[model samples]
Target: LVGSATVLCTDKTGTLTENRMALAQVWLPSGEALTLKHGQPVSKDCRKLIETAALASDPHPSDPMEVALHNARGTFAGSESSSTLPIHTYGLRPDLPAMSNIWDDDQALTICAKGAPEAIISLCRLSDDAAQKVLKAVEDMATRGIRVLAVATSTAPDRQWADSQLDYHYTLAGLVGLADPIRASVPDAITECRRAGIRVVMITGDYATTARSIASQAGIEEGEVLTGSDLEALDD
Candidate 1:
């Protein structure tokens, strides 16, 4: 029965990449981005972005992106935070591609959010001109074969609101480009699967450019993408 199976559907992050991601760059709303290098000084704005991602992420996330964001935060500062505590968590959902939470330190309450560039942009109250520029930057990064995430921060007015009450009225902080290297064995694995008459289809929430880049590297045949709306439009 296993041998008779001809189709294999799989996730992209762990199955394709090594799951070890590195922060490559950060783009602010002004079209300015910090090109990160090891052991270098991170600008105040960039540090704030990384810190926001860390605070909003899961305490111990199994997702590769969250893990990368957390590690980047640690490298920028040193050691996980010992003070801040989460007050509310807006977990990720299909409609809301981002995740956010409110954290409280002794001083004040802060709201941090992280997610797809477009999704994050929608949450931020950016002017139309600013939004277009940020989207262009995101596309540029993706064209260079890096995954991009948008991070934002705001002041939490209500300390205890239900997740559903969370609003998209936040500051447009910045965008982070992360490099998720393709796994060394993926190309060979795909080759073997093809030899066995199997068709491999990758379905992921990653950007189209990122997906296409990895697919090309892994020797997987690319086809038209069916997004949520596209699926809904299907006539099956």
Candidate 2:
């Protein structure tokens, strides 16, 4: 099977980029973006965003993104909001492309959601022009060698309603741009694979631009990207 194999499909995380993740930038609902480098000042909007992330994040997360979120929350939110907890959680799934949490605040309910920009945009119920604008922003961020995740919010009268319906029709809040370093050895590995007569392909849940960026860095040949939506269309 080794020599006869014509194609090698691989994941992007450990296979391409180093699995270590860091918060690069954040685009808020107020149309403000803050880039976090060596420790930039956190604006009120950014603090709120971090607090939301803290509320939605796992206490002991093994995922890189979750660790980043919690670390960011600690940097900004501190210990005041550490007591907050989610009443309900919609865990990440392959089909959902997003995860959500509902919290009770002063007898009112608030929902915090984080996920792929495209997936969250669909649930936001925005106008055509607005959706396109956000989509454009997402694409722009991805092309800049950053992985983008959109944040959203929605309110229900109570937790029961929020739990009953998976789609709460959230409103777009902002986007977070994360950066993961590409492994130095990846390009050389790809070259050796090519020499062995194997056609390498990068298969990932990441957006096309992000995947393409890493592929280019790892010296993978340029090629068309087939997204999940594209694969679904072919099935139809």
Cα lDDT listed for each candidate: 0.79, 0.78
Q: Please, what are the lDDT tens digits per residue for candidate 2 over residues 1-236?
A: 78798788988897688988887888876667788865567877787777676565665678898788778776765544455567778887776777887887777778888888777887787788888888788887788768888888888764454443255878777888888888998888899899988888998888889888878888889999999889888943
lDDT of 1 by residue, 95-213 (tens): 77888887776566677888887778778867788888988998888876689988887775555444452454688778888988889999899889999999888877778887777
Give per-model TM-scores.
Answer: 0.84, 0.85
lDDT of 1: 0.79
- Which segments of candidate 1 are over 4 A away from where they belong? 1-8, 158-168, 192-199
User: What residue pairs clash in candidate 1, if any at all?
Assistant: none
Candidate number with greatest lDDT: 1
Model 2 bad stretches (over 4 Å): 1-6, 76-84, 93-95, 158-160, 164-169, 232-236
Between which residue pairs do clashes occur in model 2?
A: none
